[model samples]
Target chain A: MTPASPAEPTNPPLTRRARRRNQLVAVTGLVLVWVLLWGSFTWANLIGGLLVAVVLLTVFPLPPVTFAGRIRPVPLARFWSRFLRDLVVASVQIAWLALRFGHTPRSAIIAVPLRVNTDLNLTLTAEALSLVPGSLILEADRRTGTLYVHVLGVRTLDEVQRFRRDVLDLEARIVAAIGSSEERRRVTGADPAGPPEPTRLEGTPT
Target chain B: MTLDAVLDIVAAGCLIAGALLSLAAGVALIRFPDLLSRMHAAAKPQVLGLLLVLLGCALRLRTGVDITTLVLVGVFQLATAPVAAHMVGRVAYPHDEIRRDLLLTDELAAHIDRIRADRTDRPEVSDAASAPGRG
Candidate 1:
């Protein structure tokens, strides 16, 4: 087990003022997500991503790892940009689906085996997948750390493969964004220096 | 576009959508035979539909304490809905059998005794059961 970060704050020590700010940040993120869904606007998406990042950083008090200090902000500028690009690409694909098929599109549950094992990263990946419109996280297995997503439309295996690729890419970006090196190591079963292997973890991309 | 007109359209849409979803929830609750099934119906559409209605109302009455109250109502519902369902499930646990078709594995069946003990200690039957008894 990785050691907890030295800088990680213990739960009981959260001060009232800090808690209040945290609550405020959480609420703001909620409002932003609500607005984004309501409007489906790109600007709102950017704002929501930043707001969520801030909430995760400030409000989500990471537990001390067995070895690593508290997980804090890693400079993931490239990761964020990549995620945004994926978001745009997925959004366009969803929009195309909406426009091309008015209502009677076939949908199926695709099993997506995740590369990341951390529960937090899994959840974030699920949430992000769901946000990509026309995809919903139907069920997740923490034991095997796989996710089943119901894709709005599916007609071919190639489409499924693409969906799997995009989702894994998204998960990788999220892991890079928020996870500690120890967490990554635990997930990939590799030393921090080694490349993440393509494990049995795969998703049924619709 | 007139802001008032835009707000009016949104408000109307919210109210309609909320009412429709709440109606669906009511139908589901009434149609489904068991407590868990009823809970399945009650949880999502009812909460979301009511929230939509509340949002619509809040949009219409955007200026004052009404919005705050709506927010409070939304929060209260968000917080309480799951808790109430949990309590109901716990109460109905022992006697409330599941349909074979619906359940894959009765995980809760293993801890039936513990659930019954908890209910016996509290014994606060929900109004749902009472209404059915009256009927």
Candidate 2:
């Protein structure tokens, strides 16, 4: 479901070697999950997990493993630290909102258009945004790369715009951590990929 | 305190903090007006709460396999919670349960077909939805 040629017109297809590498990565990750689930590192668990991973891969036919970028350690570490902080903040904020007496929290449904319109970027950003406390993704437009976020406890237009900018900044951090140079450049406003165009289809009045 | 005592004390604190977060989620479930806001309560605080509980469990247990299992639970929660929330939110979005009144702005309304609120929809949401944001 990633950049089906026209979406990533400039991108090249993955070669056989690259495809193999992707499969290996997937299998390894699955195996790790399986082993972790079992809670032990026995031969049986290892073998069983491998068998399951292989079967699952064969059945599912791995989606485009189109990670054309390298992981930057510094940004990745920063991203993790920032993420944990956000997580704590989100939890505390939610807890406070829940406990505060007689205060009905105002919410909003703000649609944020992502700078990096790739499927992976959309998925990752949506995942991160939703996991954060105040924000939830109601709908994501894959074609135009927009996330309709349901935010809790916002009081004004400025806050809504601030949330939008925060979403973009989050996208920038994600791209910095794992996106390609081209993708990173796009987020930073260099060679604009330009999909924030709210180009929706036939949205009618309520 | 001795080292083990200190670890146990910290573990107890983690457990208490985690339980407090869970309590917050429970309070949120009752107090949050609409279905969507309740979903935020259901998903967000509980995740951190569960992770804290697991961390406490690991520190107290100090066993390899058990810690690994706890880690697995945390991983699964982190991975699946948002996805579950998204699916539920998508379904809830088109329904009358999502209080458009309490919503300061519905920018999503402009981009998609807004479902007209059926006056005789679910009573719980209708009552809560009518309850103006007292804040």
Each model's DockQ?
Answer: 0.04, 0.29
What TM-score quantifies how close candidate 2 is to the native fold? 0.85
**What lDDT tens digits, residue by residue, belong to model 2 across residues A76-179?**
99988888888889989999998999899998887777766776788889888877758988887655566789999999767877887788888899999999
lDDT of 1 by residue, B1-135 (tens): 999989989999999878876776676555554555455445455666777899999889876556756777776775566455445544554453433333322222333344346546656432232233221
Candidate 1 error regions (>4 Å): A1-206, B111-135
Candidate 1 deviates by what RMSD? 14.3
Alpha-carbon RMSD of each model: 14.3, 10.3
For model 2, state the Cα shift of residue A77 in Å: 1.1
Q: Report lDDT (CA) for all predictions.
A: 0.53, 0.78
TM-score of chain B of 2: 0.80
What's the residue-level lDDT of A64 in candidate 2?
Answer: 58
Q: After superposing candidate 2, which stretches have Cα over 4 Å from the reference?
A: A1-13, A190-206, B113-135
lDDT per residue, candidate 2, B3-84, as tens digits? 8998999899999999999999899899999999988987889899999999999999999889888988998898888899
Real A-B contacts recovered, model 1: 0.00
